[model samples]
Target: MLSRLRRFTLCSLALVPFAGPALAGDTSAWSAREGTAARLVAGGAQEGSHDGSLIGGVEIRLPEGLKTYWRYPGDSGVPPHFDWSGSRNVEAVEVLWPAPVRFDDGGSFSIGYKRDVVLPLRITPKDRSQPVDLKLNLDFAVCGKICQPANAALDLALPPGGIGAPSAALTQALASVPRPAELGARSEPGIAAAELHHASDGATIRIATHVGNAATADLFVEGPDEDWALPLPARETGADGRTIFVLPVDGIPKGADVTTARLRFTLVDGDRAIEVDTPLSAR
Candidate 1:
């Protein structure tokens, strides 16, 4: 057993030297508010590893009823982006997404987590023998009818040592990133678009027709900002609950094209969220 352990240690050490630096010189910590559209708090650091890899994750806290978007925010929202270009002794970093919840706004939709979310991270060391340091600049979006864009920088240090279990915070985050189910179920990518037309009276919009069906779904739009008013859209049901809807352009533009609005919806049968790239057309 002793001989085997030693051999394993040597092999691990060899892989360590080849590892790249993701966090080595700078170490700062950063966080975001819990209620904003991008209600995410993230931090990064270097930690002990067997083969030059560090275990880390971005911790996010979501307020009740609020949500943060995934890599693809669906129709109207923007996804968060992480940058570590300033760190030294770091070659690369990768993000591991936990399963997300389906977010619906009346008849529109998007995919994201509500309560809280923790994003997993993969860190590689630049030097196997030296303690590694990491710095991260994180950017992401949050929404509740209105959307918000946020950015922050964090620094962390990892001592040269053996790997250990994740922190309590990490454990909680893992719980939030739910596991996916039923791979055999055929479904669209779950992304849709919403185009809002701001007219004299009220806003009018349209959602992608590719969603499950009209009767079983509801529509919602994140107004023009990340924290604004988004009235629930009226649903028009058809045979088998599948129908196309055309809302009035009361307060939205009459002839606005696709770029002006964003739409999201949720299907009732399953908790699946569908997003639409809806564009406005003349009545």
Candidate 2:
């Protein structure tokens, strides 16, 4: 039997320090942690350029068993939000999501990380050679069987030069971040349409998965941003075990058209990872 809502409880690890003081800055910037197995360790920082802008990321690690949500928290959570108001030189920060996996939490399925992961950010540096101090306020929700929301404030300082060299652990952790699956292995595009119902309260998206074998296919949604902290939506199968899923849009942008939103998701059943991308439109 497919699982239901009441069974899931999300556990999160925001900015928990597990090791020595990171070379760039100090931990005094962020708040406290709640999860013992899932703590944030300064994965390190980097300086580079994307397009023509100064770019880099504040790397963080979420180890095994403990999962973190994606920008589009499939069904019930909010994505991680970071406020970088602490640095004067910092112009902006954009998160880049590596791919994500579909997991059955409680009885509801969603997209996120199950083990070690890294989140890269594009930052405008004050001085490439001089040190830059950053203070960030982050928030997210995690689920296992009981859901709990976590909040933190973190401070990191980057020294002159660059983030230096990445440790072997960082390299391995990066490898675990989800990436886009091969297109050829995906199902046909017309198999589903996520209809959004916008109202004064919020948005509600109904995902209709059209497949020959509903029991063999599962669905997940990715967000337009990098912090995957959104909640896993509550889902229900119709009489045929294949039908529409009603998802709450509490954190989603109100009246925003998902029609143009660039999204990528996977349909995993057994060992097959069927990737799909939806163009902006309403059914």
Best TM-score among the predictions, by candidate number: 2
Tens-place lDDT per residue, model 1, 1-283, is 0111121111111110111223332222324322432212223333444556665676655666667766544433456677778766777777766555457744555556676666877777677567655566666555555555455556566564313556666655554442332211235423233345576876565543434544455444433433333333456544544333445433233343334454333322233443333333333
CA RMSD, predictions in order? 16.4, 8.2
Candidate 2, which segments miss by more than 4 Å at Cα? 1-65, 173-219, 222-283
Question: Against the correct fold, how does model 1 do in TM-score?
Answer: 0.48
> Weakest 10 consecutive residues, lDDT, candidate 2?
1-10
Worst 10 residues of 1 by lDDT: 9-18
